[model samples]
Target chain A: MTSRDVLFAAVGLITAAAAVLAVTNRRVLHAGLWLVVSLGGLAGCYLVLGAELVALVQLLVYVGAVVVLVLFALMLTRSGGGEVDTSPAHRWLAAGVGAGMTVLLGGALVAAYGWDTREVAGPGNEHIGEEIFGTWVWPFELLSLLLLAALVTAVAVATTGHSRDRAA
Target chain B: MDLPLAVEIILKAVVVLAAFLTLPLAIGQTEHKVMAHMQGRLGPMEAGPHGIAQLVADGIKFVQKEDVTPASADRWVFKLAPAVALIPYLVALAAIPWSAAWVAADVPASLLLVLAVTSVGVFGTLMAGWGSGNKYSLVGGMRAGAQLVSYELPMVLAAASVAMAAGSLSLTGIAQAWSWWWLIWQLPGALVFLVAAVAELQRVPFDSPLADSEVVFGPYTEYTGLRFAFFLLAEYAGIVVMSLLFTVLFLGGWSGPWSDTLGPLWTLLKAALVAILILWLRIAWPRVREDQLQRLAWLVLLPLALVQLALTGVGVVVWG
Candidate 1:
């Protein structure tokens, strides 16, 4: 394999390993931290693919913002104690869903591209910006509105909780 | 890579690392001496000729002191945290232009990459707090994480405005495209950037995470010797990086009267000016309440930055 292929393989492997660790880790905080590692590895994969803008956005959004949120939730709940859920009743269902998704996605991919090995040119920020604001403008705007609604709802819930506590 | 290109890259990395090591000493000493003078007191006059070698002495002392890990600490994460905190800034220096053609890495998405990588430093603080098994450290880390997250939004928005005007992510491109000094047209955005930058660096007034009086050095309470030194050095390095970024984004980076002849000297001078400005604010301002700090970042700065970004977009379209 070429050096680029090797790099991509390495990153993909790390991402997979970290993803497994994130899901299986006993400590909730450790799980969150592993999620950061997984996301970071995915960002590295993006970098290896030459999508530098996407890689950076992945780092900024996933590693920086989302992971921090996860960690914050863990800390605020005081749930860093290494207790883990040991229930296995849903294991088969989870496996079935996972397998179904894998098959569906793999089939879609194979049908669309027929196992082709062609390289796609890296879509830099300029092209991505055009796509987002031009053709995808409505969906992007709707996504932002959804985020704004979530934020407002969060604030409302917090304020109501505070008022309820004061009244009590 | 070709042999010469490989050699060049290695050489650039060495130069950046050397700067990372020494700049903190110089900037720290400058902060000490300048703050002393501002307060009409002598600062570090004894170490060697106005304490020029004081930081060197401190470095040696840190090296000699016992490296202590807390008894209950998580060993691996605690050990890895400092490198995580410091290495990103070192990598970031590669993308910063010292002069027109003097950048180590001139990638198209470099500025964004630098900001993204540096944000990962928050993980270091969080790791430090969590691994130390100290309640105070955990609280400190959480505060820092929240503060960083709040401040980053405004900073990114302000930078987005500058990127809109420049239409490129390369620092050199931004510097070259500024027909008028960006500080003139983008003053509100620049102010937002500077405030957010200061908070990002966790300097005075915004330093509740490491507030000695309150949280007992915040995330740093358990660290000792070389590890503590790493955190201290990382803070100063952050100041240097933020100053250079401000120079690149707001001030005309490496561009001044006769700057062509002066080369990187003008850039260094502007960076120094911003560094000194940071030190001035650090010494002058009293500590701000944590709530107030968050409110300023989210309530005051974020909207201002967003408005500036919109205005810059309009300006770019009309001017183009």
Candidate 2:
């Protein structure tokens, strides 16, 4: 294997390990922290696989925003010795879902690429912009519209709640 | 130019590490003396010739002091938080273009890299807050998280305008495209970026996280010695990176008289000027309340940044 393949494998391994740790960690906050490591390692894997823009965006959106937001919520919750649910049924269901996803994704990848080594170009911002705005414009705009809807709903809910408080 | 890849990487890393170590201390010293003079007071004048070595003295002290972890704190996370906070700025500094050829790593989309890495640095504060097991730290962390998430919108929008106007996502490319006209053209966006950056750094007028009277040093309440110093160093390094990034984004980095020969010097001078301006801002402004800071981001900076973005889109279309 080439050095790039080795590096990618190493990063992918770390990402998988971190993902497992994230799910299995007993402490909720520690689980979120492990999620950060998993996401970061996934970004590293993306970088090694020659997807620079995707890797950076993963770092930005997932590791930076998502995990931090989750951490923020967990921090503010003021948990007084709250235990994370570790029931056997929940664990079994999570395992089944995880296994099913793994099989589905692995099957899809095998069906599409089938271990065939095909060289792909490293993604630059310009290329990604063109692809998104050109070929995937509808999808991109649709996603933003959804985001806008959520934002408006959030503001409306917050404001109405404040007004109710004032009225009372 | 033809050196082996490993050797070149090592050299570049060493240079980046050297700058990463010194420049923040340099900026810290400047802030001390500059803030002192700005307030008509002598600030640490005895360290070495107008307190030039005050940072050095502080460094010695920090190195000698004990690294304390509270009994109730999460050991690993607490210990690791400072490094988490400091390293991202170092990585961002690496992506920053000192001059045309003076950068450590001119990644394909360096602006994104810088933005991504700096955003991740927020985890440092969050982890410290959580790991400390202090109520004040938790509150401070929540405030910081809210402020960061809110300000990030305007900051990214402002940056997106520059990227659009320059037609490149690379920091160096932006610098190369920068001209005197952009000083006027990008003024609104620049203001948004400056405000957002100051908020991001948690300095005066936006330092609710470290509101000592309210939170007793906030997330840093329990940290002592080297870890605390690391947090302070991280803040100073943040100033250095943010100022340099600002220079690259708006101030026509390395573009000055005789810049062909003195390009790196010009970049440094411009960045230093911006850093000093940031220091002046801390002195000139009073601390803002948390809600006010949020309102400023949403009501003022966000709308301003959106207008700047639309204007930039029109300008890019017309000018291109």
Candidate 3:
């Protein structure tokens, strides 16, 4: 196999491992940490696909912002560092559901699509920029508004009547 | 014989490795000296001719120091966090156009690529916090996440204004389009971008995550030795990256008065000047409260950036 193939395999393995860690880890904080690994591996996959922009966004938004916030919320609420309780019933049910969904999705994907190894050269950044600014301006503006609204909501949620709790 | 792609790749890799290896040491020394002067103290004067070897000494110290993991920490995640943090900064270096033909990888969407890579660095911080299993670290990581996400909107909007004006997302293309740089025409966008970029990098006045007095070193509180050093290096690298982006997107990359004679050197000079300015700001300013930071980003900067976007849209339609 070519070096590229080996690299892809490594990335895929790491991603799978991270996903498992995220789900199985008893500590909520540990789960969040595992999420970073999974997302980072996904980003590497994007890089290998030459979707540099998408990969970078994956790093910046998912890894940098979303997961950090999740960890922050967890820390603020939790008293100390220890493995969070995960009862056997919940674990078994989650494992079963996860396995079933994975199989179902895998089967559907394999049935619907050909396993072509051909590479596709997608549109460049300039083209995307043109399309975004020229044709997709309204949606772009809406996304900004949505983000603004989310920011406001976050502030409201974070700063509400739990001032004493937060301070503590 | 036609050289194998592997050989070419190795050669390029070496050059990049050398540059990365050297640049940080130089930049760190510069920062120490500058910070010293700012504080009215002689910094690193004893190391090697005005503290030239100061960074090298620091690097050695970090390496020699014991790398520790708290017994309560998740061992694997703790080990991985530094690499996660360092890689984003390194990958970001690929998209930055240092000079004409100087970019490591001139991806079609260089600007987007940079934003994306830098964003990933946040995950590293998050991982460090979470994996450390420290309350302070987790709180710091969360604050960083919220702060970055909130500010990212204004940052993207500000960048979009330039992309709209330049009509391209390629850093090189943007630089080339600067018959008159976008910074002058879109001063408001430039202002917003600079502010947002600083916040995005989690620098002072906006570094609620590392508010040492408050958060007790925030996400990095649990880290020590080389791992902690990596985080510090990543922060400096981030500052360099943001300064370079500002130079490229708005300040006209390497375009300057001495462009004809100085060439790429002129660009380097300009970039260094911008980096120094950022460092100066870091020294001069105090940290803003977390709530105030969010409020400023959403209520003030975001709206201002939107207005800038509107103005650009008008300008584009009218001028085109």
Give the DockQ (2 decimals) of all models: 0.77, 0.90, 0.52
The sequence of per-residue lDDT tens digits that candidate 3 reaches over residues A1-168 is 667678878998899999998887777777777787799899888777666666767876787667766666776677325677878998899889999999999899878875766564646655656788899999999999999999899888888858968778
TM-scores for all predictions = 0.96, 0.97, 0.84
> What is the iRMSD in Å for candidate 1?
0.7
Of 1 and 3, which scores higher on TM-score?
1
The true-versus-predicted C-alpha distance at residue A51 of model 3, in Å, is: 4.7
Tell me what TM-score chain B of candidate 1 gets against the true chain B: 0.97
Give the candidate number with the greatest lDDT.
2
Stretches of model 3 off by over 4 angstroms after superposition: A1-10, A46-57, A79-168, B1-4, B257-261
Docking tier of model 2: it is high
lDDT (10s digit) by residue, model 1, range B119-209: 9988888888777878888889888889999999999999889888998887888888876646677999999999999998889979998
Q: Give the per-residue Cα lDDT of candidate 3 at A67.
A: 71
Candidate 1 Cα RMSD after full superposition onto the native fold (Å): 1.7
* Recovered fraction of real interface contacts per model: 0.58, 0.92, 0.81
lDDT for each residue of candidate 1 in A1-168, tens digit (9 for 90 to 100): 679889899999999999989888888888888899999999999999988899999999899899987787676677864678866867677777878998999999999999868675688778988999999999999999999999999999999999999999
The best candidate in terms of DockQ: 2
User: Comparing 2 and 3 by TM-score, which wins?
Assistant: 2
